[model samples]
Target: MPRWIDTWMPGSGPEAPGGGYPGERLGLPAQGVSAVAGFGRRLAALTVDWLLGYGIAALFLGADVGTSPFAVLGVWFLLTAVPVAVFGSSAGMTALGIRVASVGSEPVVGVPRAVLRTALIALLVPPLVRDSDGRGWHDRAARTVVVRTRP
Candidate 1:
């Protein structure tokens, strides 16, 4: 793939007609390590993240965060962005056996992209919309994808 094309579209591409699996266009396996993560795993990972974020929010927000809400979201942003920038996986993603990786880069997304990705996820609309490859708009916008680390 050309660097310019990758620059423009990140993980977008055409694959063989019978590829028959998500992530095929991005040169990922159909199963096991580095395969595109399934929606159920992604949702479960997010549930864990949200619970953890709420726990941390309770520490500072003193019950008002349940009303304010954005504080919880803010904590979630930090929880996702910082670890994703440094380790390629948030705590929940790690626990769930997934990691976020840039489609055009080798291992991890940088801080700016991680922040953007987390912000889009916070919107609650982008993550619900997925492309053929199972990448949500948040992943697309960040030029990143979530892939399984284990089978």
Candidate 2:
């Protein structure tokens, strides 16, 4: 029996050959997360998005910006969503100190996934779309998770 396995697995010896808790590799934290924490972070992210969206809309309403209302909305969405997903933080996320990261072991993320995630997020309903993991469609589509920033 491997000593490390014994330490974490407890009752199961190394020769017991698995089937104890059934998740996580070793010392790493369990992949499963709390729904409440995720929801809170998402709410903060949404607040940031709201501010940006309304701010853009207001700007478009003004005579100074030549962009059409729809164009301004589009720009607002792009500006807000793209940077947030790829970098794991946007103006809102930055303010809230939360970041979006891939679910996989690697931290590298791409634009397409980010775009899809952002689009779903804009729907404003799908983020509430609960799955087995309690993640919304946006989170699932992006294959990303939101994490709080370190101080």
Candidate 3:
């Protein structure tokens, strides 16, 4: 039935403005620094971090990395958590001109939140599930957001 289909499928109602653009609900700027980072930027940052982690594991463990995924995971966790805890950005995020920030005024995310966020990100699914505001589950759980650093 048309009614049943409409009810079953969300976003199928009459066309209407859903409010403002992404991040506007969070009071983020439309552009420039403090604006929400887009998917491409986030993906690029993740790619860089993953490559760096892989390289580290390969360098330290050599061929052993091919046999143990945990090694790569451990390195990736460290690569993602440490810098985010101390500097609010990893090497990749810094290079991409983006940084993770708490919803509040905290300069750094601290160890606990950073660790939790990294762990969720490592699960892969959490990072792929985004909300209407474009925030991933990992970020939402950690109460952090990735924002642009430069205009």
Each model's lDDT comes to 0.86, 0.60, 0.85
Extract clashing residue pairs from model 1: none
Best by lDDT: 1
Which digits, one per residue and each the tens of the lDDT, describe model 3 over residues 29-99?
87999999998999999999999999999999998888988998999899999999999999999999999
How well is each residue in 1-151 modelled by candidate 2, as lDDT tens digits? 4664333232343322353222222222333331122567668777867668667776657764455656655765787667865676678777766677667766645777778877877777878765433356676666666655643
lDDT by residue (1-151, candidate 1, tens digit) is 5565544342454544764789887889889999999999999989999889999999998968779688888888889889999899999999999999889956669999999888988889889888778888889888888999998
lDDT of 1 at 105: 56
Error of 3 at 114 (Å): 0.4
| Native-to-model Cα distance after best TM-score fit, residue 33 in candidate 3, in Å | 1.2
Q: How far out, in Å, is residue 146 in model 1?
A: 0.6
Worst 10 residues of 3 by lDDT: 7-16
Compute each candidate's TM-score over C-alphas. 0.86, 0.63, 0.86
- Quote the positional error of residue 31 for candidate 2 in Å: 12
* Steric clash pairs (candidate 3): none
lDDT of 3: 0.85
Which has the greatest TM-score? 1
Ten-residue region with minimum lDDT total, candidate 2? 20-29
